[model samples]
Target: MIPTLILLGLVFGRWWRSSLMAAAVGWPVVLVATDVMSIEVGLLGASALATMNAAVGVVVHQMILRMTRQLRPAGSSRSGA
Candidate 1:
């Protein structure tokens, strides 16, 4: 789930190649930090959770982008204040 959130943030928030590179870099860090190789595999439900997490990430990022654009000060002006 967390990974997919990162993936969507990378995809929707950044460029495509950056997204891919982030996944490539992040996965290994997670793998090494967690060290799950010694455990047996049984986390099959992760795919479903990942999907939801990604959706949430995309939505939140899109909203933030939209809000930032809307909040930007209109036109250029001198800062004589």
Candidate 2:
């Protein structure tokens, strides 16, 4: 799901927006799941996980995008070579 969300971000050329969207969607789901399942969870722990998830998704997506750009043919439109 993280990868998919990142890909969606790439497709839309707005990785930051997608990263924030994932966090927005994920935090609430985690909160609800924890509550409905009667699981003992701490706010700090859940928040940490959500933050890590968002950071990883954005970082990885950017890295992949960078690699793709570097690997493209130099004469490609974006490369302007």
Candidate 3:
């Protein structure tokens, strides 16, 4: 789940989209897994957890991107100029 969220964050490159996708993907599994809670409760809980995890993933992805950008050589250029 963690890896999936991180991958989504990196792939999507947007926090909101990654969070929404995480919630959508997690909600069904959570709804089915916890018999102790009502559907509504499960949904809320799952959505919250998914959103938080995705946010963290997005932060991690952004940090990695920043670090990589900083590490690149100043002379490197994508353009032929």
Candidate 4:
């Protein structure tokens, strides 16, 4: 579940979208599987964790993109010379 959320963040490359996706997938389970008090506490706790993880994934995705851009030769074509 954690990895899936992170992957969602990486794929989406946006924190809000990733969080929404996580909530869409997770909220129903949390709502159905827990008691009232647990639902309240768990939703908050899970939301925070999911947001943090998604943020981390977004950071990682940005870093990878930056690194790839840096590594590529400037104005280079796909065909080797």
Against the true structure, whose lDDT is highest? 4
TM-score for each predicted model, relative to the true structure? 0.42, 0.52, 0.58, 0.60
Tens digits of lDDT, candidate 1, 1-81: 386665566456634344444444554455556875332333223333444555555656667778877887776455845
Q: Which candidate order results from sorting by TM-score in descending order?
A: 4, 3, 2, 1
lDDT of each: 0.53, 0.60, 0.66, 0.67
How good is model 3 by TM-score?
A: 0.58
Model 4: weakest 10-residue lDDT segment is: 31-40
The RMSD of every model to the true structure, in order and in angstroms, is: 5.8, 5.1, 4.0, 4.3
lDDT of 3 by residue, 1-81 (tens): 557655666665556574667566665566568664456656666667766666776777778888988998878897858
Q: After superposition, how far is residue 19 of candidate 4 from its true place, in Å?
A: 5.3
Order of quality (lDDT): 4, 3, 2, 1
Task: Give candidate 4 regions above 4 Å deviation.
Answer: 14-39, 77-81
Per-residue lDDT of candidate 4, residues 1-81 (tens digit): 578667766877645564556655575466557653354556777777766777677778888888988999899877976
- What is candidate 2's lDDT per residue for 51-70, written digit by digit as tens? 55566666766888899988
Runs with alpha carbons beyond 4 Å of true place in candidate 2:
1-13, 21-26, 37-41, 78-81
Clashes of each: 0, 0, 0, 0
Error of 4 at 6 (Å): 0.9
Of 1 and 2, the candidate ahead on TM-score is: 2
